[model samples]
Target chain A: MKRRDFITATALAAAFGLAGKPVYNVLASKDALASKTGKRLAMVIDLKKFEGNSEMMNKCVDACHSMHNVPDIEGAKEEVKWIWPEPFEHAFLEQNNQFIPENIQNNPILIMCNHCDNPPCVGVCPPKATWKRAEDGVVMMDWHRCIGCRYCMAACPYGSRSFNWRDPRPKIKNITANFPTRSKGVVEKCTFCDERIVKGLEPACVVASKMYEPEAMVFGDLNDDKSNIRKILSENYSIRRKPELSTQPEVYYLI
Target chain B: MLDKIFTGGKKYWAWMIFLSSIIGAGTLAYLHQYEVGLGVTGMGRDVTWAFYISQLTFFVGVAASAVMVVLPYYLHDYKKFGKITILGEFLAIGAVIMCMTFVFVDMGQPLRVVNMFLHPQLTSPMFWDSVSLMGYLVLNIVISRVVLNAERNGVKPPKWIKPVIYTSIPWAVSIHTVTAFLYCGLAARPFWMSAIMAPRFLATAFAAGPALLIIICFVLRKVSKFDVGKDAIQKLAVIAAYAMFANIFFLALEFFTAYYSGMHHHTQHFQLLYVGLEGNSSLVPWMWTSTVLAAISLYILINPNTRKNEKILGFGAIAVFLSIWMDKGMGLIIAGLVPNPLGYVVDYTPTLIELTISAGIFALGALIISALYKSVLTIRRQV
Candidate 1:
């Protein structure tokens, strides 16, 4: 073709391409829009509902572990846990009291990854294997990329992360086909059920807790003021693990 | 030059054989660790870093301590240190190699370590540490090779090597400081989150590094009739003495801050190391042993008459070397992880496989130093 005719044709094509970009974006799905302007997901655990209730706590723990294929190793040193329970005193070290009632003091408090707004683990990772997702504020681990240096484990103040010291495949009692089981020599942790949330479903632990006691575990977007987590957090006196460190944990405990 | 390693005497061959055996054993243990995973070691979910990382920390100091000699000779034109500056540089090369090896062994996925360079995170102190250590290693190797070759040929070194030698001085300091930042920047572990960590590391490094050099000098003189001169030994002793003093003083400052402030988080680690926390006193004996050795070393090093005696000076050097090794290598890293994040005390003791692997790395360092020193002696004899 002649040079002038080619130039005119290119201009027409460029104009159409520019015009088509906005049209394509405008027709994008709702999920894509939600991801672009993401919500700050948070969780609220009602201490009154879970306190001294080991069965309910275990149910939540089992639901998370079974769904995620967390290894049920025998020893404490090599054990892998997604969600577990700690005594009230241990959970709230800053608020420990000598005069508190024994039952309340020894009560089991459900604990998992705080999914902090500013995660030190994400910062210390040499390979950027662990990072805080900008969309939902959930700290994530890329098992394939982790070199298993354990710097993230050391940096996590809440002990939320677990290392697969051995091949975890053999230890997983009932493997879930939906979620992937991590290999040995990688750090794994609670993902805030990113997979479930993306499917418009609540976290496994939250759904499990709701079966026994409604609203015992609440999960929602903290940015949405109308969400149950925001409403509960504002109405109740809540505390977080090691707030003085200023990790700004998203998980709150309503006492 | 590489052929000199194979041209050693009977005693040299025997020593090499011994080191090779240990290396062989260590290699076997490491293979097992690789097969079975890190679970074969004592490291747990709570105490993720222990013997391997601690040794890495200790050896980084040794590598950096080459600056103690390099700065005095090249900067101040100190004639006494001229004879031994090559020795110090070669020692740094060996220590840096060991540092890299320890890091490699501690990794859960040793093969994937290339990802560190592939997807480098500038924010991580570990990334900076790897960069500084590799740079320092290359600097020492180039300086030592060029300068020593010049000496063997009866000529001055090339002009470009002077700036490279000078760059090594600050570069040495950066390696240790960056290693310290690896631990100190972690807000989670309050035990390592101290401002004085870098200074304390430098102080102990200057002491331990020269102390080991003094012992090596004595051994070289007796075995190979290689006299590095009395003045060099005395000067090194004095440097070691002052560095030990600074180390103790810095440690005292740590004690005061931990105890006087009366904060549980700050004091708990000290309590665990010194006095045994909650009836778990696994580390108390080792800490006290280090303390006693440090005290004895200081007492002998400070007295002029005792420091003047060659026989006693060797003992003092050994004392200081062992003391700092125990403190930095065995105590510091483990104590920081005890009484883990959630107020649970889970003590860690290195498994046999772990110890074997560490022993192999130490033997490798010794083997490198032995081979390099042998070459130096052979070249000097020809001159």
Candidate 2:
């Protein structure tokens, strides 16, 4: 071939390569879009609002459990729960004291996955079955990929994760068709209700709490200073469980 | 060479049959666990890892202890260990097989284990552990095969084998160290999150490994009229003694740090293991038994007169092996998980099925060791 023809052919090939968008570039552009939204989702639980309302707390638990299809297994050893009530002393050991106020001491605090910024569960999962979403700071689990090693359960300092000890399908009282139920031998936890968030809905528990008391549970983006969670955190004194562990828990409790 | 294992005497066949029965029982129990789930064991959400993980931890130490023999034989050119080096290597091959089997049976989804290789998360210590354990297993198998074949043929091993043998010394240490990191790296469990964890694991491994080897040597001497020499046994006893001392020293350091600092998170686990915490005292008796055994074994091991007596040395070795097993294999995992991350104490005891499955794995290890040793003895007899 002539030298001019060879040069022209090479130029045409390079143009096609540049023009036709590679798959990775498209992926990179999608990641860029995720960062553009750049949400750091967070939740703030106002314990004072939940002080005398055990009924309201139960409603929140039921809503989350029913929405997520969490099994109703009996006994603490084999029990699986997404959100549950724990005594104040058990939930916050660092804050326990002999002279604690009667109201605070008597009330059971609500607890769930903190969805940490630096989650140890994500770090310890051997199969990369669980990871923290870069787009939103919510830690997520892939039930199919989890080999059921339970390393994530051991790594979670909050006791937020649970394993399906038996077939969950039989245990489910009423399986939600929209949300998938996990099979036996996989770890499951709250994803900060990523499915609900994607559909522009607040987490079930947050929405449930709104009926009885608007300030009971607050969920919003921490990245946006104007967000409700950020506003609540800034105005009131709040604390997190095991904050010294440096996991940077996204969940806060308003005292 | 492999045919020698099939040609053993009546006693050998009886032992093989004994192990086979246990293995058969274990396989049946494991099938139940497979059809159901890990719930068949005593492991719950709180105490998520129990007997199986502890066995994995214990056997990794046993496997890594092969270094004690290999290092002295090759690195220092200690001719005393020459006769027994192959024994140590074979023992390692058996222990590693047990380690891998324990990991396999403990998984909830045993079939999905290939995901570890397919996905390969570098950040996870479990990933690094699988890599190191697999590497160590391959290294020991290659080194033992080459050296044993050379011995059988009355020739030196190929020049290429020297480097591989040398690589195995540190590789052995890496296997156990990585196993220790699997626990110690977790900041959530204060019982395991200590700087001394790796060193403590090595100390215990060196002690338990040699102690078990000495007992095996004694059995071989009685059963097959195979002696690895008086000097080798004495040397192994001394190695075990020093390692036990280091292990005790590390335990003392942990106790001091926990008590003196008076950190609730740190001291609570120790308190729970030693005494009952919140009415949970299931582990207290076990921990005390381990402590008493350690004390008795240390007394027997440290005295020169007692150490030189092969009869007493055998007892000391058994005591040492059992003591460390109780401490590391039984107490370590339970203490770490109980009083869990939330300071909730949940007692755990392995169910019948769990114990049966574990017994099967132990039988499998014995079967492997017996076959390997039989082959080695057959070769030595020809010489």
Candidate 3:
């Protein structure tokens, strides 16, 4: 019944150009569900397949960038970066403590914003332009409210937040044609493909998970014992990067 | 102020024209940036912030330095600072304006500065930074106005302004503390996350601020016929010498930890400055030159005989100020951002547009100081 009401409200709001009111409508309903079920969203990535699947990483990047309307400029100082993969050695440099296997040496690790449990960027933002949603734990940026100070970019440990140095809307191609182009002078980061997750679909990258090894991808409710992620966590020797930093990053890796 | 301005004759107009031209050029450069966006600046993704922020940091230190003079003069009734405290206050006012302007240009959307308050985040250091900066600005303006009013009327200020003045003493310290936290609080940037950051900032602020005061006092004596007194100059130099000692000491401690512990991520930035990480060493020469100049300047400042000698004192003041400016403003921010957290190398060089706008902001500060000095001289009659 609640789902039926959401569909009706969403259809009406879109028809009447009450676009801004829909987020509140969805959030209010989510809060109601949370009070009863107490569920939280999370992901667990298998390192085995993700270590070498460049094709999978690229596919996911394309899908994420297209959906978010991120721009590609090689020379702009304040480039807008939504998602990108980094070499494994660089991504987990601190955690590479002499025990890792040689087969995975220098392989790429698909990374976006970690969506930390204790997000430093959220804590340091003076205007609360950046926030972690209590419902799904996706760290989000409100570009309209961001003052272009780039403080969040500085505070982010992963350098996930990208600043818009130039108008990014025009640069996006037809592949990313439908994405919302950000204006010049605001900070942006990965939202774990919230637009898709909201539609009862997996993240864009998760949907493209088949391009990589089956061991390379996992996403589910961390709070549910019946969830696949919980089963994997209880069985495998899973690890998160820079555990010493205590950021409690939601993304986990099984090496 | 208008009457005195007209009284300065041909020499004053000539000086005003010279200062105005520099400021005019700077303003033109600033407008160009506004039209084209921040793309005109040399900053890039890796070194996202460049000269403007460095200059802003240096000017903030300069603005905070006025507290040293103010505390001694007002709270302790140190008559030695009587002839000079007003100059410090006015210099601070100018520095604050420049600091604010530099920050403005560095912003991607200067118009959005209002967004800071409409949706402020208490958790972000930047939120605190904005609050502290605004608080200090209001405090400096109010104190300067009240103190000048008392000075003009030939009477002490009303009792109400005293508590505010005293409050600013601690508030002055807080400005630099918050600025340092802007860097040190970042968990990923290891080079910046040191606990010594706030203390180091205070030390450098004291060191560089007094050195600048020494030079300004000399310039005033030559150009405006202001008597800052040899005794006060010597005393301030001693203060600068101690501050420099503390600054260097803190730096040395940082070095010991980075090198001794030998954490690869931690040592990479330190190596970038002194020896160049990954064979890129452009900053190496600048860093070494700054260190050498600072050490020599400290030696000169520490010696009573050398400090009292106007020529040596002048050199020492300029050297110390420049060294601290390079170390804190340029090296600190850039080095912290290096070896991008992703373990990639990112280098930055300021472009012509960035340099011009920066120069213009500095010139703007000097222009205000020159005009204010002329007005105050006319009113005070050379103290």
How accurate locally, in lDDT, is each candidate? Answer: 0.91, 0.91, 0.81
Q: What TM-score does chain B alone reach in each candidate, compared with the true chain B?
A: 0.99, 0.99, 0.96
Best-to-worst TM-score order: 2, 1, 3
Clash pairs, model 3 backbone:
A123-B123, A124-B124, A125-B124, A126-B120, A126-B121, A127-B119, A127-B120, A127-B121
In candidate 3, what are the lDDT values of residues B31-132, reduced to their tens digit?
A: 887877677877767677778888877888888888889888889898999877877877888888988898899888788888778877776777787688
Worst 10 residues of 1 chain A by lDDT: A29-38
Q: Which candidate is the best by DockQ?
A: 1
Candidate 2 CA-lDDT value: 0.91
Among incorrect, acceptable, medium and high, the docking class of model 2 is medium
Q: What would the TM-scores of all predictions be? A: 0.93, 0.94, 0.91
lDDT of 2 by residue, B1-383 (tens): 67788887889999999999999999999999999988889999999999999999999999999999999999999999998998899899999999999999988788888988898789999999989988988998999899989888999999999999999999999999999999998879998999899999999999999999999999998898688899999999999999999999999999999999999988888988899799998889989999999998998899999999999999999999999999999999889987987778898989999999999999999999999999999888821
Instruction: Give lDDT tens digits, candidate 2, residues A1-255.
Output: 999999999999998888777755756652111132679898999999998899999999999999899999989888998899999889998779889999899999999999987789998999999998988888998988899999999899999999988888888899899999998889999998999989999999999999999888999988897887887888899999988888888889988
By DockQ, highest first, what's the ranking? 1, 2, 3
Could you tell me how far off, in angstroms, the CA of residue A120 lies in candidate 3 after the best superposition?
0.8
TM-score for the first chain in candidate 1 comes to 0.84
Candidate 3 differs from the real structure by a C-alpha RMSD in angstroms, to one decimal, of 10.4
Better of 2 and 3 by DockQ: 2
Alpha-carbon interface RMSD for all candidates, in angstroms: 0.7, 0.8, 1.8
